[model samples]
Target: MPINADYKYIAAEIEFQKAETGAQKMKALRNMLSTAPTHKGAERLRADIKRRIAQLKDEIVKTKKQGKGRSFAIKREGAAQIVFIGLPNSGKSTLLSKLSSKKIKVADYEFTTTKPEVASIKFENIWLQAIEVPAVHEGYAEHKQGRQFLAIVRSADFVVVVVKEFRDIAKIQAELKKANILLRKTKEMIRFEQHMPHMVITWKDFNKKNLVRELWKAQHKIRVQTRAGHKIAPKPIVLQEGATVETVAKTIHKDMIRKFRFAKVRGPSAAFKDQQVGLEHVLKDTDIVEVFMK
Candidate 1:
């Protein structure tokens, strides 16, 4: 306390006492510093206030750094990572549970999920990672952990905007736009374009099967099964759209490209059954191929 401190200084002291978070304490300490006494007698007191303010600032910075590291840390698994964002109680948890069969905390109240909840969503022979992020609100980008959360969203392979009402989509979009995350779609299909992540707005049609189908479509990837004689591999090789035999060979092993002679196709991309095609042949979804080496 400064000697002959006025009401403003006293008010700041009260605010400091009531502050709950480091950021709040920093604000109150700043006010205290401004109204602090400037006389020789109060020099020591002012120095102490300055020291406290500096310490608070350092702590806040350190806490934000640690938070960013922890909050945005998500290990990408499966074929792709898709994150779901919406306002609180917007069926995000329900959708996650239905799609992934993972039990998530579902409540009628708000902010039930304060952090990211992740699960694996299987689409036929392929799997995708789904994460439910905390609700987005106005000024979300300015919130303490909002930036970190948005960073995680931005790094996702795709984003699904879950909303309770159709109009609420704009609110989530606004928050995402604040972080430069733009939503792109083609017809009813949305996908990643340029450097931006792909996104889809869904308020209805929470069907698990359809959702998985759309998610796989948006990724623009195809599943190709390899065949050796009459036996076909159980797990299919997932590849991007417009992928060719060369691409598939390269995916199996880099050395296959050099030793490759030709591939026998059996499904969608095949002109005829067991069609012999060169490495430049384009493949399609669910195409069964068998590479024959010279």
Candidate 2:
């Protein structure tokens, strides 16, 4: 049976997915646990939430004990956060510098990058934040710094596994798996097909543009432009796929949801010019929404 989750639970889930820090994730998870349905069918869901909450608490404690004023946290920016992860000497920094157009230090030695290096890469009309995390190795999840690094990966919207050879992909994947980071192929985004469960792109065919496109598609998001009168907003509001008119209203203003009267739509989602839609109406990319308040 379906969980039939309510709006509060769904909103909490969105917050959890976008949370950048352990504290933020903890808050979202707590909200999810509180708002989740208290039905027999949802017992497993509740248990899973409780288990994750406990795990996060332990991780937070371990991180605090390990760090004495050091932090691995990178502030998320732009449309999305794409993390570049791999084993040592995997050319992660090379890809990061090329894509972001930033002068990042590139070296031949192992573990050259000791910390997280971040920059922004534009994808057509929007820009995305890209981060090259310190390399992963065997028993990485057990190490103090490695734990912090994996935390960053967990918060990323998309992950690109960089490697010098195709075989090295397995090594990186194994290390990431130890940290509970799962990688899956998004066939819809790119045409490359691999035997592994993770999305592994060939280094020969991979370039700055391809990386940007893959990140955009893997994010599973849509850009919606909210309109006022005859003028539309200069920047579109980024939201997850399947976002509805109610979702847009809440994003614009919390009160907009409560005081919602109706909304007028145009662009891709609308069936007719300036069509009237209710809160449940799903929005599409480039859709223009004009919300009316009671």
Best by TM-score: 1
Local distance difference test scores for all models: 0.78, 0.77
Model 2: how far is 270 from its true place, Å? 1.9
TM-score of each: 0.71, 0.69
Tens digit of lDDT per residue, candidate 2, span 1-294? 122555566557656766778889999999989988898878988898899999999999998998756487577767887778888887778878878879889888998998888888988767899888888889888888888988887777767777778888777767767777655546443211221222455568576777678678777788887776666666677899999999987775465677788999998889998899999999987798887766
- Least well predicted 10-residue stretch by lDDT in candidate 1: 1-10
- Model 1, runs deviating above 4 Å: 1-71, 184-186, 189-203
- Give the per-residue Cα lDDT of candidate 1 at 179: 81
